[model samples]
Target: MNSINRILIAGSFLLLAACSPKIYGTVQLVDANLQPIQAAQDSPQGSIVNMINTTGSIGQSSHAVTVDVEGKFESEKEKVTPGMYKVEASRIGYATETETVEIKKFTGKKIEFKLKKILEGKRATIKGAASDEDKIINPGEVSIQPPSM
Candidate 1:
């Protein structure tokens, strides 16, 4: 009976480790000031990152991992297959960034992404509103203060 139980346990361990690639990596979210976000992995204000498996083989599905407080994320051992994946990062006030990351031979990789903030107070300035043929002179907005003239 003891021998049978030991054999069964060994077989189970082998079956569990037979196949499925294991890939790993770290993710980080930084503002325009190049500062690390405190709650980068939290919701509402924290950035959301997902890895979509675009290989399209058969039964493969996309995988989503939560980044740590220090902006680090790792994929599950068997969930991540060896192929091309689309990494997308999104935040509330920051721009959404999408990038392609490949996992070759189940090797670990490091990916870094920088987010650009949207300016709300800055005025939008349109340059070259006039066509080339209809060149208008003195279109610049210049404020001149004259005391006497």
Candidate 2:
């Protein structure tokens, strides 16, 4: 009787394990120039990565994770189920980006977000003046001043 109970328990455990699928991926945040954004120590939550399982009902299956200092986020081990996920990355000063991905395995898929900087109010561009004997100013020598309220 004891041996039979042990065998049944083992089979049940195996069945449960087989039913659960593992899903994971990496989210990368970058600027318009394709430069990686690193999180500052002062602002720990540099960016937010929200994953919604679009395969099923909306809002019911959603997960939100914060990116690390390297502006990267990975799903927890076996925490996410295999399905179609709509991933979104957002930052305070940058435009939000979204992508629809199918996460079916545990492979570390890389998703990159190119966020454009949002400029508010007016922006002034000042060009550098020519100096010395050279009457031509250096090209691309432009400075952007923050908009004043």
Candidate 3:
């Protein structure tokens, strides 16, 4: 009976630990000049530090961290899995940044993102694709809108 009780307790501990999340890194938010910028610690949803999945999966937003006034952020220690993720940061008047990073299971690791200044009417197209390419993705019939009377 003593052995059985001990085994049960050990199993419970393992189960709880497995359910906990894993933290990727000690992320820090920076600006274009490579200077640390303090993120709003007002609310979790309004935080400047957010992790995005590069694969465009809408369901991968479970892990989020509220950056402190020192611009340092951290995710749940045991709720996140080790994998490739995009550490995104956005601030008013600053260009949004999405940095591709590989999150590891190791602790005390840190990731830094540098945000740029937003340019007016800046082209956001990815490189290597010609502007006048004949190939059309999701092509649809062109509609001519008559001038409103």
Could you tally the backbone clashes for each prediction? 0, 0, 7
**Candidate 1 at residue 59, lDDT?**
71
Error in Å for residue 128 of model 3: 43
Q: Give lDDT tens digits, candidate 2, residues 1-149.
A: 69999999999988776655433344454555766556441332457888788885654488878877555576665556778888888878778888888766533446766665555768799876567665655668967789999
Instruction: In angstroms, give how far residue 58 of model 2 lies from its true place.
Output: 5.9
Candidates sorted on lDDT, descending = 2, 1, 3
Model 1 stretches astray by more than 4 angstroms: 1-26, 33-46, 121-149
Best by lDDT: 2
lDDT value for model 2: 0.66
TM for candidate 1 is 0.53
lDDT of each residue in 1-149, candidate 1, tens digit only: 69999999999888766544544444555556866655534322245667788884657768777656555666677777778888877666777778887776636556666665544677898887567678655757656878986
User: What TM-score fits each model?
Assistant: 0.53, 0.53, 0.45
lDDT of 3 by residue, 20-65 (tens): 5343333344455766555562222234666664543466644567
